[model samples]
Target: MNFKGLFRHFTDMKHYFVVVLVVFAISFYLGWANSDRYSFFLEGQLQGLKSVSQSLSAKGNPQIWYFIFIFLNNAVKSVLIIFLGLFFGVLPLYMLVANGMILGYVLSLQTNESTLSVVLKGILPHGIIEIPVILIACAYGLKVGMLVWKMGGQLFLPVERRTARRELANVFRLSKTLIVAIVALLLLAAIIESTLTYWLVHL
Candidate 1:
């Protein structure tokens, strides 16, 4: 893989990444501030997640099961959002908000534990990598959404169509490299979450 090229490609999408980050931040803040109002919805989501975790843990080798589940869940969703961004980028943006809100709600529920301790022990270990990968994937999806919009607008304009087409091609090429990198990082994050994070949280 052309690591340098991939890095350059990622840097080129900094604006989209910033937009995703800002949206996620705002959604997180909203979720945190309105935790009481959204408790019913958010708690249900958490319960669903808990159920899945419990089911996975019921099987032997819980750590392995956890790692596989987390990695596949994240990897598949990330890749899907990237391609599904073709639908005017709405799905990716919604996912960003949903994930951010869920995280915020989870943190707000930690009244008994110090928030810092929870973050440092339970989240930061894997989130440092997983969060950024998800953001990058969403950013690329947003890029694709923009290109689709542009392509539609320029359908009748030959010169603009050619430019948009070329840009779309380039985005797809970079996305292949990005997806590979995302999966690899997510695998590492899942490993950390399933073992190190779990151990730390239980302690």
Candidate 2:
């Protein structure tokens, strides 16, 4: 997608960005505060992460295989968030919380300076794209949930067939844009993370 299109989408849906930011902050605080108490949980989580990375490294060139692995993983996840939003937006919210918490916990395991370095060198390179794409997916998913609710409410109205059809069409149109943007953003993020971020962090 062009920069203008992406910019317009972001500007048009500022509220969703705020929602994601708020959720991430809350989850981060919780993860930081409970890091010690949840040490075992974090250990298990780290192990799982390690295995995934290790598998990528085992391949001849981590950058290529890693990009594919991460792209597929993130694309599936983001798409699920968008589609699963139909369940009263619970799934998207849950995903944001879970991901934010995991990130917070992982960062908290290091010293403040180390955490800053990690975020700067490892995460930021791709996070600028990846995080926003995730938020957009969640936002669209939440919108779908709202549309479903509105449709449900409209069902009780005396003459709502046409209105309901219009709303459904709108949801479908918006969803198409969301899916396209999410896939494109995730693909770029995977490439940057697997190459640029990896190189920076290793350096």
Candidate 3:
């Protein structure tokens, strides 16, 4: 992979990163303050996560199996979010908000620092890598939507061939770079979650 190119693209797309941060912060505050109001909506999500945890605990799986599971699970979700941005960026936005709200609700459930610490330890080991990777995917996904919109405009103005070509090239390069970074980060995140994170939480 061309590291320099990837770095250039990331720097060029700083606005999207800002978007992710802003959305996450807004939704997190909402989840923290209004969790009770959205309890019905969040119930399913909470239950699903609970069920996954329970199943893992029940099976007592080997580390390798856990790693594989985490990687595939997260990879699927991440890719879906990235591709869903094709929907004029709405789907990706919804997912970002949903995840932030769920996290906020979870954080709100804890009454004390001890509980929060435990949760943070369990998540942070992998989350440090995972969260940024996810956000990057989201940012690139949103970029796809914007490019698509530009391409649409270009369709109506074939005279702007040079501009259209530039947009197309950018879209291709950005997608490739995001895919490489996300895959590598998710793999590392899976390893950490299945090993260091799992042990830390269990201990």
Compare the candidates by TM-score and give the number of the best one: 1
- How does model 1 fare in lDDT? 0.89
Question: Mind giving the per-residue lDDT tens digits that candidate 3 earns over 64-114?
Answer: 777887898878878777777778888778878888898888888877556
- lDDT tens digits by residue: candidate 1, 88-193: 9889888888899999988888889899999999999999999999998898888889989988888888684457778888888777787889999999999999
User: Candidate 2 residues 1-203, lDDT tens each?
Assistant: 24455556667567877887898889878777888877686678678879999998998988898889899999999998877977978888888887777788888877746778889997999999998788778877776677777778887777746375575565565666667878988999998998899899788
lDDT for predicted candidate 2 compared with the true structure: 0.80
Candidate 1 backbone collisions, by pair = none
Q: What TM-score would each prediction reach against the true structure?
A: 0.95, 0.85, 0.88
In angstroms, the error of model 3 at 50 is 1.6
Which stretches of candidate 1 lie above 4 Å from their native place?
A: none
Go through the candidates in order and give the clash count of each. 0, 0, 0
Q: Candidate 2, which segments miss by more than 4 Å at Cα?
A: 1-12, 37-45, 161-165
